[model samples]
Target: MTTSALSAPPLHSSAHDDNVPNGEDQAQRAAELAALHRAADAGEEAAAWVRQLAGRQGEEEHGRLLERVAEAIVKASSREIIPGSDGLLTEELRYTLAADVVLGASHTTGTLPELHPGERMPLIAVCSIAATLPSCVLGDLVREVEVLAAEMEAATDAGRAAELPAAG
Candidate 1:
């Protein structure tokens, strides 16, 4: 997708004049634009990689999840950096999310008991793939996965309790 599609709106509206001089304001705006462009480029490249990986693995659902995670990371990071910025570019978000999903799946799969030899190979591959992502993105993914795992564990425990015989 085009960079424009992935890019967030300008951080500051020109309509509201700031205290800074005209030239200075223009320069600041230019810098912000440049940063946005860089972010968009990075996001697009990540997204393309995710798509290729998903296609190779024949895991459309995992791909979609990873893309969403990537998008969330970009959006959150962009907002943190640019006060008035709308968020990550659409394309960037898509790619980021795809990668995040794959990472999360790999993490979950790795934690399970291996039913067959080499079952953990995908997890190893995913870790290598995750190494390519920014630390901030990985941090966010870990937090998300932790929350999900906790919820799943709670549900499983509840199910097990339900299966127990009634107390005498």
Candidate 2:
């Protein structure tokens, strides 16, 4: 599939305005456009990889998910959620695993998982399973996170949740 189909429509036009005094604005806009295009291309690449891994009657849903995730990662790359740290381009996903399995509604939480930069294969596998299987991918992820939280005191079970939703 084309990269344009995978990426989002630009929020603003990159056309140059004559009224603008300097070329600074146009230059910045050009840079942003370039970055966005690159990200879109990357997302497409990732989606293709996911589809190839899934095979013949591929996991179409998960392939699309990767496309969206890649695009979002490119946009949010600058925010630095884990300040001063460089790793997976991660952000809180859309699916909510648990609202309040044990705690009251007020204490509801999630398990936010990070996609390390070097660990794309595992993620692709997880997403593929999520897309094809009629199972709660988020639940499994939450359980894994709970285990990690136990091993590493720094991790929190109730606070962070990763949203790896099935292909709908």
Candidate 3:
């Protein structure tokens, strides 16, 4: 799977520069905010996709998938991180973040956003979960979900085919 790099918006720096113009700083801040909004939107879409995939499975199968996800999370989290890497997030943190999103999205009520109380997680919520994660992690998470979805679909189709009477 191709890992697409996601550019996160720059965090606001506390230091004030006397030499820089105020207007330019304001414009830059606005741009950064826009980038963050875009990232949040992307994260929400990814969550929805995973939820859909989970919805296709039976209860037992869904439970199995969740188990697999848990196992994956544990494995991913146990890996050692390289010292002084350029990545803003470590592999463990990324996996944990992705797992949180995936688990929340895969909840039974997570597919529908219109319900009051039980509503699917809002974009803001998803953004909060993904705020620190880089785009590559989201991309990887989506790719893995897609693979699982495909496998589930194929298995379902095969079962159906087996149930049908053989063509005379």
> Model 3: per-residue lDDT, tens digit, 1-168?
654444433345335756443777777556544443444444434444334434444554453453443333232222211123342455544544452443443466444222222222332233233423333234443343334334333433443344356789
Order the candidates by TM-score, highest first: 1, 3, 2
Residues 1-168 of candidate 1: C-alpha lDDT, one tens digit per residue: 455733655556675656434767677566555544454444344434333444444344555554554445444333333433342244554444342343445554543221123322332333223222333233343343334333323433443344356789
Return the TM-score for candidate 3, rounded to 2 decimals: 0.34
User: For each candidate, what TM-score against the reference?
Assistant: 0.38, 0.30, 0.34
lDDT for position 159 in model 1: 30
Query: Model-by-model lDDT, in order?
Result: 0.40, 0.32, 0.39
Put the candidates in lDDT order, highest first. Answer: 1, 3, 2
Residue pairs with colliding backbones in model 2 are: 110-160, 110-161, 111-160, 111-161, 111-162, 112-160, 112-161
Over 4 Å off in model 3, which ranges?
1-21, 59-87, 96-168
In model 2, the runs with Cα more than 4 Å from the true position are 1-21, 56-93, 96-168
* lDDT for position 43 in model 3: 41
By TM-score, the better pick of 1 and 3 is: 1
> Residue-wise lDDT of candidate 2 within 43-96, one digit each (tens)?
344434333322321334433444554443233322322222442333253231
